[model samples]
Structure formats: C-alpha cells, structure tokens
Target: MAQVEITINSKNYRIACEDGQESRIASLAAMVDSHVKDLVEQIGQIGDTRLLVMASLLIADELVDLREIEREVSSEGGAAVPGDGEEKIVSALNAMAGRIESIADQLERA
Candidate 1:
C-alpha cells in the first residue's frame, strides 16, 4: 500500500491505495474536491462533515445513474449508442431515393 496526499476544499488528506495507484487516487480526490468547492461556493463553508456527506451523496447519485444506463443497454442485447449505425441507414435510404428519381426521369424521357 502507498499513501497519497490529496487536497480537497483546501484541506489536505492522506489516503492509502494499492502501490502505483497514487495517481488514480489523486485524480479521484480532485473530482471530489471540485464537488466540495462547488458546494462551498454555492452554500458557503458548510461544516466539513456536512460537506463530505453531501459530496458523497452527489457521487453516489452519479454512480446510480450510470449503473441504470448500463443495465438498460445490457438488457437490450447490447449497447445501441445514440446515432450508432445511423450513417448506414441514411446511406441506404438515399440510394433508394436516387433509384426512384432515376426511374422517374426514365419515365419522363419515354
């Protein structure tokens, strides 16, 4: 285990994590600090305990939303990202429309 020093809301914290994972820990801490800083700016120096609790809740909410999306995508056989395969559909439709136009042109010429 290695200890990483992280600063959140101007306060320093020493956290332990797997060896060589210090960067990951610091990155995650920065995200939490950003949330805490935003909370402080909006709500003003709420007690540390309250700030931590609220931040934790906010992160949890994000995780829940992400999990829900993953579940929905998995249940549909596989993830169907927004606009995935859209280009192919559009290409096929355009080709059909072009063929129809060509037929119409031929009819007019005849």
Candidate 2:
C-alpha cells in the first residue's frame, strides 16, 4: 500500500491505497473537493459532515445521469464503427463511467 496526500476544503488528508494508485486517489480527492466547494459557494457553509453528504448525493446523481445518457447514445447506434470518431467517443465515455464509479467508491469509503 501507498499513502497519498489529498486536499479537501483546504484541509489535507493522507489516504492509503494500493501501490501506483496515487494519481487516481489524488483525482478522486480533487473531484470531491470541487463538488464540496460548489455546494459551499451556492448554499454557504453548512458544516463539514452535511456538506460532504450533500456533495456525495450530487455526485451520485451526476453519475446516474451520465450513465443514462451513455445508454441512450449506445441504443441509438451513436457509437462509431471501425476507424471512426464514434468509436473514440464511445471509448471515452466508457472510461469516464469507470472513473466516476471509482470516485463514487472513494466517496462511500470516505
């Protein structure tokens, strides 16, 4: 295991993860921090625990919406066929979904 230092709301946290996952862990922390910051800006400070809960819900909703959009696009044959942009777009979307799932898992554990 390796330790990664992540910052949220300007506070630093040292989290442990499998080796070579430092970048992923840092990305996860940045996502959470961004969400929390947005929430705070929109509604004003509401305590750490409450803000974190709200941010988690908001992030979850975003992930669900993205997944739904991806499903719709796939059903409509929007994915690119051999040697086309559609294939690249589809691949990118799949990668995003995987990343979102990883962030969600991190939020849940936090």
Candidate 3:
C-alpha cells in the first residue's frame, strides 16, 4: 500500500491505497474539494467537518436525483437509440451515478 495526501475543504488527508492508485485517489480528492468549494462559496466559511458532511449530503442528493431521472427516462423509452441526445444523457448519467457511488463508498470507509 501507498499513502496519498489530498486536500479537501482546505484540510489535508493522508489516505492509504494500493500502489498505482494515486490518480484515482487524487481524482476523488478533487471531487470532494470541488463540492466543498461550492458549499463554501454559497454559505461562506462553515466549519470543516460540517462542510464535509453537507457536501456529502449534497452529493448524495445529486445521485438520487440523477437515478430518478434515469428511471423516468428509461420507463418512457427516452433513449431509444445510440448517438441520440437522450441516449448520451442517459449514458452520462449512468457513469456519473457509478462515480458517485464509488465516492460515497470510499467516504463511508474513510
């Protein structure tokens, strides 16, 4: 295992991961940081732990919203073929949900 240092909500974290997983860890950190930044920008200077918790909740809400939209679209046969805009949106939403799940799992483990 290797240690990766990441900064989120202006605080640094040292997380352990297997070798060759540095990029993935960094990517996860970036996402968290982005969320935290958004929260900070909106609310202006909250406690780090509270900000992190709020960020997680916001991310989870986003995932749930996307899943609902995906279900509705699928039920309505919105994406009927490849190359169509609806198909692309559905695909993107699926990928995003997968990423969000992975991030949530990681956060839970952390």
**lDDT (Cα, tens digit) per residue for candidate 3, span 59-96:** 78667767776786688697655556566557766776
What CA RMSD would you report for each candidate? 19.6, 9.0, 8.9
Top candidate (TM-score): 1
**Which residue pairs in candidate 3 have backbone atoms (N, alpha carbon, C) closer than 3 angstroms, thus clashing?**
none
The C-alpha TM-scores of every prediction are 0.71, 0.69, 0.66
**lDDT (Cα, tens digit) per residue for candidate 2, span 1-110:** 89999998888999999999999999998999998886666556668887788778767866776677578667768754545555645666677556655655554565
* Tens digits of per-residue lDDT for model 1, 1-110: 89999998898999999999999999999999987886676567768887788778667755665565556557866647665345444554565445535633543454
Local distance difference test scores for all models: 0.71, 0.75, 0.75
> What stretches of model 3 exceed 4 Å from their correct place?
81-110
User: TM-score of predicted model 3?
Assistant: 0.66
> Model 2: how far is 19 from its true place, Å?
0.5
Candidate 1 accuracy as TM-score = 0.71
| Candidate 1 wrong stretches, greater than 4 Å | 84-110
Residue 3's C-alpha lDDT in candidate 2?
98
